[model samples]
Target: MLRIKKLDIFVLKSFLLLFAGTFFICLFIFMMQFLWRYVDELVGKGLEINVLAQFFFYSGLTLIPLSLPLAILLAALMTFGNFGERYELLSMKAAGIPLLRIIRPVVLFCVFLGGMSFFFQNIIGPRAQKQLWTLLVSMKQKSPEVDIPEGVFYSDIDGYNIYVKHKDRKTGLLKDILIYNFSDGFENAHIIWAAEGKLELTADKQHLFLHLYNGEQFENLKSQSVISRNVPYRRETFKEKHTLIQFSSEFNMVDGSFLDRRSDIKNMHEISVAIDSLTTHADSVGRSMYSDIMSTTYRGAVLTPADSVKIKTENIAVINTDSIYNSMTSQEKLKVLTTTENRVKSLSTDWDMKSFLTKDTDNSIRSHRSDWHKKITLSLACIIFFFIGAPLGAIIRKGGLGMPVVISVLIFVIYYIIDSGATRVAKSGEMNIVLGTWMSTIVLAPLGAFFTYKSNKDSVVFNLDVYAAFFRKLLGIRQSRHMFKKEVIIHTPEYAKDIEILDEISKDCQTYLETHRLKGMPNYIQIFTNNKHDDAIAEISKKMEALIEELSNTKDAVLLNLMNNYPFLSVKAHKSLFDNRWLNLLFGIIVPAGLLLYLNIWRYRLRLEKDLRVIIKTNQSIIEQIEKQQLYLQK
Candidate 1:
């Protein structure tokens, strides 16, 4: 027990070290994203140090859940990778330590972290998001700090474009200023130019005042009321001039109370409550609007009691809209129709707007529910990542940050893409919110478990050799060499006995080839029904193998080489007997089975014919050598 604990502690220490590094790295990445998204709000706002610090603080907190899972994934990957790369995993496994036992400590730690993440998401994270979003929104309304550059038209101001050829920043003096004011509309405008000017902000910082010296103003005095164009223009030269532009420089925060708390900023519990409230409200609104439309259009007909529906009463005066219109003067008829049309248009517009509102409410409800599920789902991701990373690392057996980082990033990207798609689906209400929010976890959890299972069983899931072979076969670019261990033969062949056997096998093969026509159409039924004929091939194959063995025994290099040149009998026999199932299925489907079987038989016959030719040539050569040896022996 003590030894096991020590081992687990050692493994955990390494994992934690990597976790610390990776967690901060993940957080930094998310922080950079936050910066990019809100950089415009932060750049020239002149925010205080405390405010900026607070933003970073909340941003980091809000990003914790996101970063935790990735950190765990990377840490587990790195730790196990180190183990496998160094062959420490091999030693442990040899010592009977299972993969699960090796990763137990890290798994427990991840679970603990997952719980902490949940706590933060449910309790602390909401507050941080609320504050962060509030601050960001506040900065949006705050005016951009004054940064007017020279040689460019500054159109940050509404309805105005002001340009300065040169400005002395130290002295805060502008030279050769041009300002265009289109506040009254582009058709009528005022153009102002100054030899020298100074820009200043009002005491309240609500307005920008441009004080100009030796300037001129041009105003086009063409009233929109006048039909004629280019009627009048006014240009005035002045010793000094002042124009005020509306600009708010103060930093005013929006009321946080008015901000919706039911957004993603809410905690799971709060979100659930919000969902319930929204659902009830949406139902009530839809019911009320539909009821109003029906009641107004049909005058309570649809709301009739069951008893009234059943009653067959005498003929009643029905409303004849055509006759009512005919009874009226054209003016009165026009008025009545105008009123009815307006009423119908109003009802239809109201109905459409309400329907849209109801759908929007439903979508919001789904979003909130998804957010609630996400709190748990993201927390669960930490655990899932640990299982995945640890086993994957073990399988890959790569140490350091290089391969592990690449793998972790790829996995996380896949996960995030799936999560994003699921969230969109949930938001659109095409899928159940619970399933949608948990979809990534659902997909990933089993994969992690499978990796664990493979690791525990010592399965070669990441054996590059296996993958390489598969791809090689797929591309038809590689062949595998099956090595056979050479045997140490104690005795040389009895040439007299081996020669007789080889002669007999050769004669049989030659006769079978010469007498049969390989080009004939095959009886496909015989393929299945004629196991009898198949055994004959097997028998011939066995006899061929015996001859090759005898030739190897002769201890003659030339004869051994000849035997080596011959195809393996087992390979030739089975080649026609069975093929890749995919090819068989393809042939069976695309062509009639009889034709396919016949074609296969024809192919096999041709193959047999070739093999027989090789055998016959080999036998002839051996027979000549035996005759020469016998004559020498007689001499």
Candidate 2:
């Protein structure tokens, strides 16, 4: 039995609203990019409104799969971000509903969205891709609308360059026109100058009609010339001349059947079939190439006794070809060398062609295989992106379009870069097709899982202070303690106890420094192998901190300032790099990396020694100040 709660409906409604809007936004953006790539082909073509509409429609359909993952990512981020921002997520968690339970409905919806993405890619995308390509080709072939500008040569026509000095738009009359007709050959060209001409397109839009009022035509009869430098020309002066120029302005679509050979215009089943067929063809060609090379190039030689001498065991004795070459005449040697060189060259060229053929077939197979995995990977990417975006939104606790949009774009860009690079390498046969096609998924899935786990457990995944502290520990950076005089002293600090603690801390620091040889460099091997804790330094640090805490309540500003000067000590700064002995040994075994790490450890050791010296010095100053005040009170 299934029950739909108000929570599920609420979550679904929020996500669906955002998803619908983001899907269209992503689709429009991708379509704009797609159109920009072929803007040159579409502009000036004078395509009809319905044709342009169909182009956009098919383009959107084809880009639906690409847009789905980004749309889901943005929508999930915004949905969860809004929830967390509005305190709805907090209220739900407080009401005993975990983050996972809240997001379960959205997850299921994302799964459904993934299915829809796969459907669009497999069923609708192929037809849209084919139609879009066909329309683009048709647009490219269609002639530009005829509007001859003044004073510029219009070479958009196939074989004619027409220059108009001035033209009347209302009456469509040109004042001065110069035309170069190279339709016959460049050498046999015709140049025409017209005083006034009117250009019109035929009803079928296939040819240009040029009616000149007064013009002279010059024809170079180079083809009729018999000798060089004796070219003849004919000049004709006419009052009225009508010239028909061949220009096809009508839009004719290319046959899309040829596009079927493309891997993108195929379904999974078709791609699988293509892969099998290409693999089989490639294998057969390789086998045939091997057989041809063996049978034709390496055909066994049948020899008589004169060609080679036979031994007692009926095996021919080996002969030195250099000795045989030395015995030959010069012309015979040259002839034999020429023949061998030609044969070797012929064999090399034939093998190269065969190798290229085999490589082409293998590339095709890889392409088909990559596309086959692409369909499934894109679908899975939708779900992966949702998981990532939703959990990240919850962790970041950012709502509205600003932060969510930026994060979503960043994540999607990373995914797109990985997928594109991997797909290219896979197509080039440099990597396994499956791994390359699914590389983005593999890289991001664990990240999504980690975010989900962190968000579910209400962990601090993005807290800057936690990471700052970690980096401080890693770099052995010691922060100065900030102590100030309290306005109201809960318990007055006893100067006698503070002086005693300082004395003990100073003594421990001196003893540790003397025994541990703080001034010298640490032994590299001992640094890694030894896991001993510096209990002496730790005890000194513990007492110093406790004394500072007690004296922080004192009304004396000088004591507060002196307490602040005591440096904060890190207990494990000079300890073994790792707690695990095996890891330490392994790091030691790696020479280059271990050397660098050992140097870093030695630097930390030096810092630790310096901090201990500073502590001892600061403790002596504070002790002297406390004893001076006590002696003043007695006086």
* Best candidate according to lDDT: 2
**Candidate 1: count of backbone clashes, pairs at least 3 residues apart or interchain:** 0
What range of 10 consecutive residues in model 1 has the weakest lDDT sum?
Answer: 476-485
Off by over 4 Å in 2: 222-225, 299-319, 484-492, 520-532, 554-558, 577-603, 627-635
Tens-place lDDT per residue, model 2, 1-635, is: 65889999999999999999999999999999999999977798889998899999999999999999999999999999999999899999999998888988888888998999899999899878889888888888888999899989999988889999999989999988999999998988899999999999999788889899888999987645456777779999999999888888877888888787789889999888888888888888888988887777865222344543444356745757789899999999999889889888888998889888988888888888888889999999999998899999888888889999999999999999999999999889889889999999999999999999999999999899999989987776667688876777889889998888888888888888888876587888787797777887788888888888887877777877877778878676577777788898899899998888888877777877888888888888888888887888899
lDDT at 557 for candidate 1? 51
TM-score of model 1 vs. true structure: 0.75
lDDT of 2 at 407: 95
Q: For each candidate, what TM-score against the reference?
A: 0.75, 0.92
In model 2, where is the ten-residue run with the lowest total lDDT? 300-309
